[model samples]
Target: MSALPNNPPPNVSKDAVARSLAEAHRLTDPEITMIFRIEKPGQESNPAEPVKLLEVNPNTTASGIMPVKLMPHAPSGIFFPSVIVEVHPTELEDLKNGNLLLPNGWKVNYDRPL
Candidate 1:
């Protein structure tokens, strides 16, 4: 029997490869963060606040940042892309104060329990 190919598809970019690796890390050695929907300017109440477990990346080009998969705010089976940002590892402090702003304009607040 022939062995299956293990390499990624030919159309993948470097960023995609890096993200894939990061996602692998997230699956195994994972970290958690509180995700908040960034309220739009002049908007009213925000949406649901969900806590997500992500991967801890210590040596990213962007220092002190991690990858977080942003799930849909509403109750559904749809999936969303990820947002990378600096994560405050201290859960208590983050809970007390707030989290760092993400590249996607949202905020990530604490390291949640697994």
Candidate 2:
């Protein structure tokens, strides 16, 4: 489990994360699945929530992009900030090019390992 610098708003829910991941994965690849595990709050001792990289889809998309997700082992009472998982280098580029869509008020991080 890793730590995120920002925590998600209270309104954020696990279902939302699952749904978003599912949708994102579907857009990137149908066979991709996401696993999320949230870290305990107050654990980071900062505003950031820690998120870990659990798994990635084995199947690659036409652009050689793999679907990725943040899996937290245990979530605290609060929802942490949004973390972006980039399977390929171009994915980030696509995001910058407005080729991809993401939820509002969500922050994108390209630091996740491929």
Candidate 3:
């Protein structure tokens, strides 16, 4: 018996490849930013404040910063993206106090464990 071709069947639509390329291009562009709201335990969501587009560490044991405007005024909890910076509580506190300065018009929001 003849061996089947390694590639996809010829019946597949050519538009499929084009569509996939378009999607990949969109994902690669830096203009896309995913926003995730922070949620506290026992609470469905934070009504007073909400954190969006938070950056988090890899080990799931650290917190990071985001734009001040995007951060909540009275944050109950904070959410972050899968990739974040790993920092100690003390360091986070220092950052809050303005000791750690970021670029102009930028602020650091700590996502500590409650």
Q: Which stretches of candidate 1 lie over 4 Å from their true place?
A: 1-24, 28-54, 63-78, 86-105, 111-114
**lDDT of candidate 2 over 28-88, digit per residue (tens):** 6665454333234344334444332222344534253233344342353324444434334
Error of 1 at 78 (Å): 6.3
Using TM-score, give the best candidate's number: 2
| TM-score of model 3 (CA atoms) | 0.23
Residue pairs that clash (backbone atoms under 3 angstroms), model 1: 31-54
Question: Per-residue lDDT for 88 in model 2?
Answer: 42
Instruction: Supply the TM-score for candidate 2.
Output: 0.32
- Each prediction's whole-model lDDT (CA): 0.35, 0.42, 0.32
Best by lDDT: 2
Clashing pairs in 3: 56-83, 56-84, 57-84
For lDDT, candidate 1 versus 3, the one ahead is: 1
Candidate 1 TM-score to native = 0.26
* TM-scores for every predicted model: 0.26, 0.32, 0.23
Residues 44-103 of candidate 3 have per-residue lDDT tens digits of 222322222232223233334433332211132122111123334444555568765443
- Please identify which of the two predictions, 1 or 2, would achieve the higher lDDT against the true structure: 2
